[model samples]
Target: MITFAPGPSKVFDQVGQYLQDAFQTGILSANHRSAAFMNLYQETETLFKEKLHVPEDYKLLFTSSATENWEIIAQSIVESSSFHIYSGSFGKKWYTFAQHLNEATGSHKLGTEDALDVAGLEIDGKHDLIAITQNETSNATEVSQELLGALGEKYPDKMIAVDTTSSMGGIALDFSLADIWFASVQKCFGLPAGLGVLILSPKAIAKCESKGESGRYNSLSFMLENAKIYQTHYTPNVLGVYLLKRSMEDHPEIQVTDALVRKRMKELETVIAQSKKLTMLVQNSETRSKTVMGIAGEELFIKEFKKAAEQAGMQMGSGYGPLKPTSFRIANFPAITEQEFENLLKFLKEY
Candidate 1:
């Protein structure tokens, strides 16, 4: 069946084989501290740096998933306050996690969530840090480059973090503007779940080292220290790492200037326009994510579309938040071919 769900969507043929081969070679059975495992781990980090155009000063750390990274950031980096910029559920969730962490650690009253009225809102440079989700998978919303740059200018003293979970590999990321940028490989990377890629700036590292009194495991300082030598403090999803490494190796090019990405987006726009029963969810094109498109239509249309599509061999994503009743999502990642898209459109038309 075709999977148009946001993540754990698809994997390259080679990535699948790599997992099978790894199991056969007993690489999955070897100790995590062994030289062989360390070499593989280091190579994966190197590949990430090359593919993500991650700055030399920034460090990369792999975790279980983006959910775990949220706790890591909340526990290690957020001590006093964080001005969270929220446009969707993921961003709101991160802010909630920080609030809970603050209450648990008693780390000086944490900050409140700022309403994401992009035009009227201004970044208060007073907070300890600024957090924004680069791409919102749930709503197919994105914080624009202009917004990030403006915030950086106003909040030079505060560190900035981004959740790029759905945008990495599918878009060009400017890590220079944000202190921490992270993603999960399952979405745009065309791999399975269980691996989250996190990159940290020097300033973020300093904050972690200073505020990491929250304890171990979720400590960014510990992750950073071990990452220096290419390792994780705890046992990692070794097979997921192998698939990530193989996927990166398979597509070494970092810059995602694919004409096809643009072409498919345009095609989707045309399709969206023609369907009277359906409409693109996000109001702003500037903030719409290229990787995932949120579609809102008649509830009957969605229910019928979902049921018919599944019978005809398609798997569309359920809505993430309050929109679950009226909205669905479409993934336009690299692995989805033009023919497949045409088929999807045809199915939609028929249904």
Candidate 2:
């Protein structure tokens, strides 16, 4: 089945052949620190930086998943105090994690409130970090870059960490404004699960250093120090890393630019606009994610839509959380073909 599920949706065609060759070539079982492995690792990191347009000084760190990055950020950056902004289900999870941390370590969380209606946040220097989920995958909401810039500028002293899990590769992100940015490869990188890419500015690295020995595993400093030697603290998902490397290489910037993605998004906008029953979940176009588009239909229509798509050998995403059964999320990441988009539209029209 062609998976349109939010994550683990589909792998690149070339990536599959690459993975098969990987095992046959013995690169799958190669030592993490081997010369051949490091070459691939470094090349992957360099390609990511090039494609993502990350600043030269920023460093890319790999982990098991975005969830693991949550733990790493929670343990290392939250310190004794923080201010968390929550807009939707995923944001609420981060806030809940913070509350749990508060109870466990007696740490303080200040100005914790739902980010959906957050108009004005008063920032004091007391809070060590300010957490924001760049894109709310659950609710199909994204905080705009202008708002993020305002928050960062308004609170120069507050360290910022953002979760760009669902929208990273499909959208244009300004990594300079955020102290730390992380994403899961499954959603936008067109790869399988079990790998998360994290980019940290020098400021974020310095904050981790200030923590002073954050118990080995979840420490950003530890990852940074070890990554220099082309290694991970634990046995990294070497296969996933290699696949990610291959995917990055396969989709170069010269051929697939953000402008191309934006153009496709515009085309999708026209398609969505023409559909009477299939409206968008996000009211504001400015905040809509280019990669994932949530469609609003009745419960019966959603079921019909899914059934029809599956019968046609296509998979579509279900609305998450509060919108489940009322909507379907359509992922139009770069890896998806034009024919697939047409097929989805055809199915929508029939239902």
Candidate 3:
């Protein structure tokens, strides 16, 4: 069935052909240390940097999942305290994970009604790292670029780490806003759920070196050293990396993809706004996520809506966390074609 789930939601129509190419070229069997594998790795990094507009100085590394980056940041980057700003479950989980490593960990929970106003929020001077979720997958809320820029200016000394799990590939992000940015491939990258992309600014690298903590195999220093030569600290998901490279090559310009997503978002939002039975979970229009749209309605209506959509040959995402019974989510990733989205919108309008 066609899927509108938030993650692992859809794969590009050409992904199967790319997989076949990988297998024919024996890339799937190549050793991580082999020249062929290193070339593939370097090509993937180069494409990601060029397409995503990542800075030349920033380093790109891969991990098992975005969750792994949370552990790495706590273990290798934060020395005294880490402050998390969150409005959803994943962000809360990241803060709780940091608390286990640093006793001085703190958090700021943004109210659902308040626009993300980090410039007005007071952060403790002792907090060395400021963590922000660029997109909250659970509630379909987003942190505005203006707020991120304001935080970067206000706290230049503090490391800014952003979680862009659901928004990364489909949207264009200003790389200068955060010292460290990470996302899993299962979402917007239109790949399977085995790899995470971590981009680190030079400031982040210095923080890791200055901290002088190095033991884990995935530590920043170790990963950086291996990444310099286009390699990983351990064996990685070669197939997933190959798929990501192919996806990037297909849509080489991020701005073009971002525009497509924006157009589709406008279409979907218009339909959602006009729906008599459905309402947005994110009340503020400015904060609603472009990549993942969350809709709320009566329990019976939601159940019937999902059931009818499924019967019409579509699989939609159930609402995350506490909103599960009253809401549902739809992914607006690049992998979803305009025709497919139009079909879904038509179904919603008719339902």
Top-scoring candidate (TM-score): 3
What lDDT tens digits, residue by residue, belong to model 2 across residues 1-351?
Answer: 677677767766677797897898898888877887777778877887788788888888889888788778878776766677656677777777776766532221222122333346665566778888777777667777888888888888878889889878877788899898999888778888888988899888888888865565768777888778777777778898888877777776623656766777677778778887778887677667667777887899788878878888988888887789898787767667667766666666665
Worst 10 residues of 3 by lDDT: 111-120
lDDT per residue for candidate 3 within 134-180, as digits (tens), equals 89999999988888999999988899999999999989999988999
TM-score of each: 0.90, 0.91, 0.98
Question: Clashes in model 2: which pairs?
Answer: 86-115
Ranking by TM-score: 3, 2, 1
Q: Give the lowest summed-lDDT range of ten residues in model 1.
A: 105-114
2 against 3, candidate with superior lDDT: 3
What is the model-wide C-alpha lDDT for candidate 2? 0.76
**Deviating ranges (above 4 Å) for candidate 3:** none
Q: What is the Cα-based TM-score of model 1?
A: 0.90
Regions more than 4 Å wrong, model 2? 103-119
Q: What would the per-residue lDDT of candidate 1 be over residues 215-319, giving only the tens digit for each residue?
A: 577677777777777778889888888877877887746565345666788788778878879888875677777788888988887898888888988899988
- Clashing residue pairs in candidate 1 are none
Query: Residue 157 of candidate 3: its Cα lDDT?
Result: 86
Prediction 2 TM-score vs. true: 0.91
